[model samples]
Target: MLHLRVIAPEHLREQVLDVLRNEPGVGNLLFYPGVALLPEGDEITADVARECVNDVIRKLKQLDIQHEGAITLHSLETVLSTRAHHAEEAAEGDAADALVWDELIARTREDSTLTMTFLLFMILACLLAAIGVATDSSVTVVGAMVVGPEFGPLAALAVALVQRRARLARQAVAALLIGLPVAMAITGLVTLGAEAGGWITLDDVKNVHQVDFIYRVGPISLVVALLAGAAGMLSLISSKSGALVGVFISVTTVPAAGFAVVAAVLGDWSVAGRSALQLLVNLVGIVIAGVVVLVLHPRKSLIPRSVQPN
Candidate 1:
């Protein structure tokens, strides 16, 4: 179940109330007229079933409440009321299968943005990966994987493509194209500096054992990426963040990029090429898998004809 707090303008208060009253999946509705100071409107709160949330939010959007006032959605971790149980039973679909499009799009857009924080995480992850490669440390590589922010844009790109949002797709692609190369270049420079400081020697790179797999592009790498991508998409839709973290650690994206950078710095063009190929394979596999997952579990409209926009 979800809790919605809506601020509705005076003119739209009656419509909002009517919509809430008529929906079987909505209960515990409360209205406070002229209570919203910033928006200068009525404050309305209701508990709605997860399956019915998208319909309610879409109806709210059609009323232009998002522009004139505000709407906030919150998940209800524990709902002990009989009304809540009835609401869930009355809802059209299962809560676990629900896909809140508005929330998903907003989250992906925010994550895909090339912010300073994003760049910092990417650079740091790549540097960590470089060090892991040099020292042949699987633990360090996993840490870099967890720190990497590349999955956001990659997931966004898949979502954009599935939604047919060209602008969002372009933004995601741009972030990937620019962010990966920048991360790699910065990692390369850091690698050179480390060698100069005698922090990493050629022998360390050549003798890497556990981390050497990062630079080896193989069929297994693609399969792992595909599996991770599917798991990542499932985690996003179901809001299982812990599963998403596992997905991050399961893939070798950051480590591959880091390996490519260090290999190039050491004039190992063959290793560098293979690492670059590994990165490419992972990116392509993840995106393709994400799109497939979204396609398989589509968001269906449940809004009433009277409430739906023309």
Candidate 2:
């Protein structure tokens, strides 16, 4: 089922509830002072039903006596009407609150010029990527990818764009800039160490030349990064959190970072530069695409409304 937020003016609430109660598609209505949730429908096939909801929301906003109620709709991932679920429900609220707090930490720029968390993430991501490349293991590569803190900035970029928070944008950009270099450097060092241990060789660097990773910066790369970015933004808006992991794998950011160090260690300057380019291209594509998708989603009122913490 789908979820909706309806806002209405104080005096017209009775009329609003009357209309909502009689609304054919609406299943269950939970009345509140200024806002309420309604089970929109079980059958949502195409654009027609969606338009109907939007139209209803628009009409209700007009009758808003005290405040023109803006209507927002979202997918309902789970439902628990029981009292135990209610206590358990607070778990999601706590987690969301924690996320908001973390966002603040990530978004806030320290006056000291560099943040410890950013630096730590960069170092950690780079080291992990280097280990993966050295081992030539996809498992390790994925670990490195997941370890890479780039996702935070990427998500932050979307949030910044949606809220028009320039400070957040700048902070995210800064994190990317500092994080990439630090990560690459750490991997470079790791690569050098792996070389000394005879784990990775110049042969591996040369092989990377023939390998077609996402960093080639062609139309396909651009398209994949764009799709990943859009999907990432959508995941954020819709609260389908599983998609976030897909976002990491969908883009070439982590792989490029790994390849950059491998190339650097083998003195394959060409490969290093190309991988760097690939990283930059993917990052730019994801950021721009994320910004655009968020802008579009909010306008369509497709973004899930963040509930106020009660």
Candidate 3:
């Protein structure tokens, strides 16, 4: 069960409340048209897990009474509103309205940009990840994952695919395809120098084969990518950003890339290739899953019969 709180002007309060009440799985609907105190905690309406939050906002715009308002949606750990749990509701992409693919693309644009911000973040991320892999420190690897800016490009790609923004889609794909390889190659060259200097030896890195066993190939990496993609998209759209944690957890891109770089340094091509393959699987999985999800879930009617506009 999700709880939503909406803050709008008193005059249009009833209309907003009515619309929210009509939403499927939305219960305990309450609106204060006249109350004038900022409520505690976050507004639940903002977190409302709808395929098209934009539509709801559009409908609310008609009321014309909104001064300053915010809505928040909370995923209840245990929703007693019905037998169905939040996870089940979430998994089904169950929402009151059908959201189109373009919405996801627009959302991704909100936080990410195509300029230098992308390059700087990724470089830093890859550098850190390479250091982590060479040290055989899982802690550093996780840190690199957190640091990597790959999620922004990934989310952008998913959004573009769903919305059919051909130009934008091509750009995003190019970024993802080109960004990691370049970064990894740089890390690899640096790793080779580090190894030759006796700063880190093959004994330290070679034993990592045990770590590569699981992620070498197959479906697990793909599954991680899919989940990461979904979580990354969800994080982009959501107000609370709880899913960011999931995004950080699900993507093996940084770790694998770092491992591959480490292997490159030690001249261990087999493990390097396997790790690179793992990273690829994860990337493909996330982008495909993100696109599929947005395609499946669509937003509400942008055009009403009476108010059709060209």
Candidate 4:
């Protein structure tokens, strides 16, 4: 369930209340007259089932409440009331299968931002992967994959493409283009320094076989990437965040970038090229799969014809 708060202007008060009253998934509706000062409107709140969130929000948006007033959605960790339970049961689908489009867009938008923390995670993950490649450590490579932050922007890119959100698409692309190369360059320099300090011998870095799967691209790689992308997007939509950890570790994107840089530092151009290709194939497959999943998501209209936009 979600807690919905709305501030409706004087003229639209009845319209807002009517919609909430008619919505079967809404319970505990509370309206406070003239409670809003900043937006200068009446305040309305309701306990709404998660399954009906997208539909309710769409109707509210059609009313221009976002421009004239405000709308806020909050997650409810626990709903103890019988009314809330009935509301959920009355809604069209299960909360676990709900597709909250606005929430997803907001989440992906935030994650795609090119913040310092994001870059730091990318660099650290790649560095860990470089060490894994140098020592032929599959476990360390898996750890690096789990730590990689690349999936966020990749997911954002897919969402942006399907939604036709130009700004978000640009942000996601820029983050990927900038983040990956920067991480690679930093990792390359560190690899060179490690070799100089004898922390990693040339033979140790060159004799990588157990983790060669990081650079080896095959038909199965694309299949796995597609599967992971769909699962990741579905998990995001259903808020099954624990599933995302598995999605993160299933792809070889971070490991490929790390391996490519380490190989380049060792003057292994052939291996570096193959590693880069592996990275590209995984990225493209994930984006393509994510777009398809989002486009095919079940979004049957739950709004009444009267409330829906013409």
Candidate 5:
């Protein structure tokens, strides 16, 4: 369930009440009039089922509450009230199957932005992956995969394409296009420095049998990427964040990028090319799969007719 806190303008108070009161998915509605000093409006709060939140938010948006006042939502970890149970039962769909698009778009927008912290994580993840590749350590490679932050932008890119949000698409694309190459270049330079300093050798790069999967691109690679992409998107929508760790380890994007740089530094063009191909395959497969999943499960169908825009 979600707890909605709405500050409605004086004139729109009755309209907001009508929407909330008429909805079968709302429980424990509370209203406080002349209590909002900053917004100068009435403060209304309600506990709403997850399946009905999208419609409620849409109705609130239609009244321009965001502009004239404010609307805030919080996920409830536990609801003990009978009314809450009734609300969920009365909603159109199961909570797990419900898709809250506004929340998702907001989340992806924040995650897709290219920030200093994001770049640092990218570089660090690649560096770890490079070491794992050099030492032929699958464990270290897995750690690097979990550490990589590329999936956020990839997911965001998929959402942007489906939603047709030009600015969001630009942001997600910029993050991916800029982040991966930057990490690869930095890792390559570091690998070269390590080689010169006697920390690593070309033989180490050539003889990594245990981690060779990072560079070997095959049909299965695309298939795994496709599955991971779909799983990741579903996890995001369902709010099953724990499932994301499995998604992270399932794809070899970060490790492949790291291995490509390491192989290039060691003067193995053939291995580097194959590693790059692996990275490309994973990226393209994930994006395509994500787009397909989003297209298949659209948000419009979940919206209640009473809240849909005319």
Candidate 6:
């Protein structure tokens, strides 16, 4: 279930009330007139089944409440109301099967942004991967994968494409186009610095046995990427975040990028090219898989009526 707090202008309050009254999945409605200070409107609150929230949000958007008012949603972790239970039971579809478009778009928008934290994690992951490759440690490579933030933009790209949101697609692409190269450059410099400080040697890069597969691109890599992509998308939709950790560990994106950066640092163009190919293969596989999953399970309209423009 979800809790919604809405601030609607006086003029639109009636329409909002009507919509709520007609929605079978909403309950525990409360209204307070002229309670909003910033928007100078009436405040309303309600409990809604997760399966029906997308329709409610779309209706509110159609009312243009976002321009002069505010609507916020929160998860109702523990709902004690019998009315809420009835509302959920009355909803048409299961919550897990319902695709909350607005919530998902919002989440992807936030995650796909090229933030400093995202950059730091990508670089750190690459650094760890570079070390992992040099020392031929699969465990370290897995740790690097877990720390990488590349999946956010990658997932965002898929979501945007499936939703046909051009702006979001561009943002997601920008995050990747900028983030990956930046991560590679920084990791390469770090590799050079480490070598200068005698923390690593060329011998470490050349003697890699266990981690040599990081640079070997093949059908197996594509298969792993496809499976990881599907699992990642499922984890996001199901809110099973722990499953995302497994997706991270299963893919070769971060490790491949790390290997490419280290190989470039060592001037091993052949190895660098192969690692780069592996990275590209994994990225393409994941994006294709995510798009396929989202397309297959298209978003459903919770409400039949379109939101009227105010």
**Which model scores highest in lDDT?**
5
What is the C-alpha lDDT profile of model 2 across 1-310, one tens digit per residue? 3466555545566766665554444544666552333322212111112223443454565665225444455545565544323333322222221222122333333321247876776677667666555555566667666666686687676667766778777877788777778777777777778789888897766654224463466778888888988887666645556997788777768778778878777888887788788888888888788778755653322223255443
Report the poorest 10 consecutive residues by lDDT, candidate 5. Answer: 299-308
The global Cα lDDT (0 to 1) of model 4 is 0.90
Please give the TM-score that candidate 3 achieves against the real structure.
0.62
Clashes of each: 0, 0, 18, 0, 0, 0
lDDT of 4 by residue, 183-263 (tens): 999998999999888877657656888898887788989999999999999888878899999999899999999998988
Clashing pairs for model 6 are none
Candidate number that wins on TM-score, 1 or 6? 6
Clash-forming residue pairs, model 1: none
C-alpha RMSD for every candidate: 5.0, 11.5, 9.6, 4.7, 4.4, 5.2
lDDT of each: 0.88, 0.60, 0.62, 0.90, 0.90, 0.88
Model 5: lDDT of residue 234? 93
What is the C-alpha local distance difference test score of candidate 6?
0.88
Which digits, one per residue and each the tens of the lDDT, describe model 3 over residues 50-118?
443445555665665244555544444544543233322432243433342334555566434555667
- Put down candidate 6 lDDT per residue, 1-310, tens digits, no spaces: 8899999999999999998989999999999999999989999999998888888998999999889799998777799999988898777766766767777778878888988988888889988999898788989998999999888888899999888999999999998888888988999898999888987776777788888889888999999999999999888877789999999998989899999988888778888899999999999999999998888764543443234121
Better of 3 and 4 by lDDT: 4
Query: Between 1 and 5, whose TM-score is larger?
Result: 5
lDDT pick, better of 4 and 6: 4
Query: lDDT (0-100) at residue 286 of candidate 1?
Result: 96
